[model samples]
Target: MTAPHVESDQVRTLFSRAMSEMYRAEVPQYGTLVELVDDTNRETLQRHNELRASLERSGDLDRLGVERHGAIRLGSAEELFNSRRVFAVMGMYPVGYYDLSVANVPVHATAFRPIADEALRRNPFRVFTSLLRLELIEDEALRSEAARILAARRIFTPRALELVGIFETEGGLTRQQAEEFVHEALETFRWHGDAKVSLDVYQKLHDAHRLIADVVSFKGPHINHLTPRTLDIDAVQAAMPKRGVTPKAVIEGPPRRNCAILLRQTSFKALDEPIIFTQANAGTHTARFGEIEQRGVALTPKGRALYDKLLGSVRRHVGAEGIGPNAGDYGAELAERFKAFPDDWAELRAQGLAFFRYSATPAGIEASKRRALPSTVDGLIAGGFLHADPIVYEDFLPVSAAGIFQSNLGTDEQQNYTGRSNRAAFEAALGAEVHDEFAMYAQAEQTSLEQALVRLGSPHVARKAIA
Candidate 1:
């Protein structure tokens, strides 16, 4: 008898838990961070009843603990192309192209995540996968050597490749195959202390860019960091030092806001682990770290534009006078500048600044059965026939991401490359085009609105509202 097809969401959940367990063992600090987040979340929920209610109503409460995002850097296109297929078995697809090269980080990235609402609710595990840009290295000899070293190593094991092929040929993996796949796939992200190159080669790549060296020197692209979502990042940041974890000087994102926008990230410093090179020479490498994030409502294009403009304005102001060593001054400037953004969810929806999911509450559902119905969405909302809830931001911010990387990698590791964004080249390497995140948000919003109207038995109103 053929084995029943297991749901991809189940596979994703299994893989996510497995990854967390693996990382916790590899880096014990991660376990502490996870505990801190869990404690903070519990306190947040207990202290703020309304916040808890909001999460429960929005179906976010269930996924809070399971929600995690991890980062990994790959050295070659072949690895990236194949990795895409590997993630596909777990129901993750590439979303949002991020060019860290613009920030002079010398790598381009895309977030691989589940797009379906149910899959996300099940386990919104994401991986911020970046591909190293060897060409960015100005030294031709060093760049060629880096490329040759990267090309020589196969990141994925033979068994992992075989499993991925099986999944591709078959629609879904059986439970036995999935269990095997998870174990085999975990090997790629497992830390290997032995470097494939000599200390001299490693030094050259490190000189070009620390990230380049990290990617090219490793036997496999080990999972750099696994981020757990927290309801209160400020609490986590404040408590980090107390818990023996030293957080970065500044939280890398917008200052605190009543309505958090995009993503706010803070991380503990990277661990300096000893490694043995090809010649059995010992040296230290710093890469893996513990990261935490707090996500907020997804902004529309207009909202994002305003946010960018304000962020840029603050950066310019701070840059002109030079940011103080404390970073408190910069945070003050950021918070003051962001006051221009409205905090009220209703005002945001009214101004079309953020995406919202429309649904009929129980009261609204009962009210919709009445013969008198409102034609417009606003009227329906006014009449208690429908409700709009903020859609959680499921993506990332490029500037914030670069900041986290730079903080952990060290300020001295930064190199200025020309602002080169090669989306075409990145996509060409992946063997598939990335899904536009904005488009996905728009679709979700429209779909929610349509569903709400259908629930109200007003298809015509939905057509007019969507129009």
Candidate 2:
């Protein structure tokens, strides 16, 4: 008898359910993390009417914050393009492209942010995008061999492509049609083929795959980690290790009198899973899946200002240098500067004219002028600054991402370590260009503020009251 076919929508739903189940089964603590986030939001709302009202108007998932998303990458364009069709059936529109090749890390990565608020509401799905690192490998022969293997490997089945084509042409189908499409698409992506391989071949494939497994294993186009923004990530960080959730390094973002914005983070360590490997006997052997590690880097206000200044300065310098009439030169300069000063927050802060902090005392002087300065969030609040609320760092961390991949797969195995991949590759593969992640997040925050004004019935009143 043939297997019972399911619809695309149903397939999407099932996929989501299965993913959540897998995550929960593997990391039961994540469930608690979800609950904690909800509870914290609820309590926050009860304590701060203004914040509650502002968030409510934003049209985001209440208590859940904006939207929960995950990202992953695949090795091929066919998978990337076809995945778009599959996602559409589930009401997920591709939003952005991320290239991790140029990332100052070991692994190549990419991302696709979602567009459907309702689908997100139903189930916060992940965007899996992949990246190819031409620079990781030093041996041209291995690179050639690996590329051939990847090229030959069919990431998506024929049925998946057909369904995607139908969905694209129809835009959307009737509820019944939608259901059918969703089922087929999900099965197509989820189905593990029955192609038989010798133990040696299996092991070789597995080894080659580790080069990009972090991007492939997950259903999405690549391996994308879903980040949940929290005002109290530090609290979560502190509590996580005890709960079996190892805490990676914490990146402190802009320090506000009351809160910190953009605390960069990564998982404390990578976990290893078991994979089947081929042995000399041509029999199957179990091998550790490999460890997945994470890292976190903080960006302070000074860091942000320096980043901005670097862009502006690069623009000015590029124009002076006669690199281009347009802003491309400036952008390239900015990217270069960022790489050079990846962690020069202290140096940036030293340049008082570019980045300075105000004192909390009644004198209203620059903190650097005083003998004492506030270091903690609470301390800043005590100094009379209204403790600006923390903004969720709703973006990927390149180093952390690379670190995770490197941890899972040995980075040293890469054949090429030059000729980096750019963000363009990610865009071309996914067919969805990635934008400034920080800007998108900032817009979300601004939209919430705007909505709050509408709710208040007057922008002036809302501004004054909120201020």
| Runs with alpha carbons beyond 4 Å of true place in candidate 2 | 1-18, 26-29, 35-50, 61-66, 94-97, 102-110, 116-128, 134-136, 176-210, 213-229, 249-263, 279-394, 403-421, 435-467
Worst 10 residues of 2 by lDDT: 286-295
Tens-digit lDDT string for candidate 1 (1-467): 99987888888888989999999999999999999999999999999997887788678899999899999999889999999999999999999999886566888999999998878888999999999887788998888888888889998889989988988888889999999999999999999999999999888887777888899998899999999999999999999999999998778777787887888999998999999999889999989999999999899888999898988787667741123343457778888999999888878888888888888777777766785787888888878778787788998887788877877776445467648888999999999999988888888889988988888888788342221
Clash list (residue pairs), candidate 1:
none
What is the Cα-based TM-score of model 2? 0.59
lDDT of each: 0.86, 0.43
Q: Lowest-lDDT window of 10 residues in candidate 1?
A: 319-328
Candidate 1 versus truth, CA RMSD in Å, comes to 2.0
* Model 2 C-alpha lDDT per residue in residues 208-294, reported as the tens digit of each score: 645443333323332223344454454555666665666543322222213222333334333443333223232322211211111
